[model samples]
Target: MTPANARLARLRGGIPAVEVGARGIESVARNAGCTRLRAIVISGLTPTEIIKHVFNAEPDIMSPFAMTLSQAYERRLLENGGASLLTAYREKGHLATSEVKISSVADHAPGGGVLARQRRELETQRLLDMKHAGNPLAPNLILNPRLPLALVGVTHAIELDYMVASDDARSYRVGVIKSYADRGGKTDKADIRAACREAAVGTLALRQHLESRGDDPDLAGDRIDMVLRAPGSFVPRLFASMRAESEMASLVRTLSTAPADLDEVEQLVPAGTSFADPRVINQIPNNYRSNCKEHCALWERCRAQALAAGQPIILGDAAAEQLAAAGSITRALDLLDGRGRPPDNRAEAALATELRAAALLLDRIANG
Candidate 1:
């Protein structure tokens, strides 16, 4: 086997197996284009308390502001007519008091534990079945609905914040409540993209479940209703309706193909290996980038390795690309110092000339 594949195999064996959930889906979607990140996640080496204390501390994604805003938004939705407002916004019409029925699965599952999660899942399925069966008593608005998604060898229960039916009651749209605020008609583009990606995963899971039950998958629409705070107030409003067909297709492909990749990597795992062994972890290759600090638990280790190896990537992507031909930062420094052999290629010769000119300018300035 190739050296890289062998290292990946060792990494796969070292980490414990973990089940992917709604948050996992968001992580995958956020880094959809990063193959190394995807491989790391598939290997099941996530951030843990031990790792956090050992390695550099990762910035918390959930801040106090975010937490407070989310709690307030949910509370307003429950206490006020937020549900009806969202339904009307989604359906693009007025919702009558008689037509809007709100139900909550969160109340049945009070405490946070495995048992609570299971209860919520069961209740969500029961309500969904009733709604699909056209039961008059079925709720039109469901809070904290958990939907199941069967993957290659595992199943994921994705819990959504809200699920509201369309005006005709023939279809349902996923509602994602985010803490990001909307200023006028604009919101943070990156935040919106991330929220939409998460919504896509939920929509796909719901659609697949409906198809499995012999119901119309189209009942789960592709559009996601994003609920965000108003321009200056904490009042929730429907900010954007994003179509997630492309994002959903991308996630489906990832879920379908990830297992095959893992299986191939698993073939090279040694017997009785575990990530708790620091030797095994050190043997694994590191893919370091500037953004690694934002999401990776092993960013410090990876960054140190990159610096020790004199890899130009420690300087960031653009600098790395420009200095690719130099092979290493040490070699680039040697070239700059005019201590290396004559440039063998046009690109290297041009780089040498530029470095000499810049060095000369710096010398003149320093002398003055």
Candidate 2:
């Protein structure tokens, strides 16, 4: 097996490149699963923390969904019609839109019977002319070591609810993963807590349901415990972290036969886009989604209304800056350092406490 440091280096430096035109919001949303839809914020830690301990990263791709989607879609398109249409489309637009249109002279206007038949024949034969590859997105996105945050939890078990595009002859799925590995971190107690307070004001908010420190964790790191007395009418916040780490993956794979751009590859994810007719959600008897009670970030509004006829707070996507803020490595350091703020977790706080206690030991080791 590759050594852990090598793996960390590879993840940092080995990302693929994509043409500029291929970049879009879809992939970003899919990678991070953040859209203008119902949004929530979350925090925790996992594999990423360990990697940071092993290898330093700057300007990391915290979440990359578009690339994951492109990987899923391209394989399907190329196989069905060969690469001519795809190639042509790419040549024309370079991969920005979610839709495409194809046309032939024979289909557009009347041609001689022979000419029309030849045109149809041309399409059939042309597809056969080019050899095609099999699916690439199915296994890799799921198996990648750097799974997405949406697929993880405090328990570290990965939940696979990723996307899929299946039809006759082949299938590709982007399995949703959940693990504590990508959990958000909070060291900026004032900043993050302030934001949380803003988010919680309308609802009966949180008072540190749990705490952690870096000294030791009941689970992974040190832990923090809290007692939350809420109206029981609150929304459990969950940020749209990446469902797939297309941006973070080193080097491209079979998604394309050649070198690829991680930036462009990420544009094809579908998560940030809207779902079908969200407005009609209340009309549906059981609601279009059975798990909406738990899944919806606006669950508080839903619960409040159902319980005590509370007024509605419309659903919206998680705040982008806030989500981005939670994942900063600096914040991790703060949690570990405890310089100016409260440690978000007991594990982090304890580590800081120890680091201060062992400052001379740490300095001696650094010099050595």
Best prediction by TM-score: 1
| Among all candidates shown, the one with the greatest lDDT | 1
* Candidate 2 TM-score, C-alpha based: 0.19
Query: Model 1, 235-275: lDDT tens per residue?
Result: 66675456877777777776755334555435434457645
lDDT digits (tens) for residues 219-259 of candidate 2: 11111111111122121122322122222121012222111
Quote each prediction's TM-score: 0.73, 0.19
Total backbone clashes of model 1?
1
- Give residue 23's error in model 1 in angstroms: 2.5
- Please, what is the whole-model Cα lDDT of each candidate in the order they appear? 0.67, 0.26
Alpha-carbon shift of residue 306 in model 1 (angstroms) = 3.5
lDDT of 1 at 202: 79
The regions of model 1 sitting more than 4 angstroms off are 1-20, 33-45, 48-50, 53-61, 78-98, 167-169, 184-186, 216-219, 256-262, 265-269, 279-286, 320-368
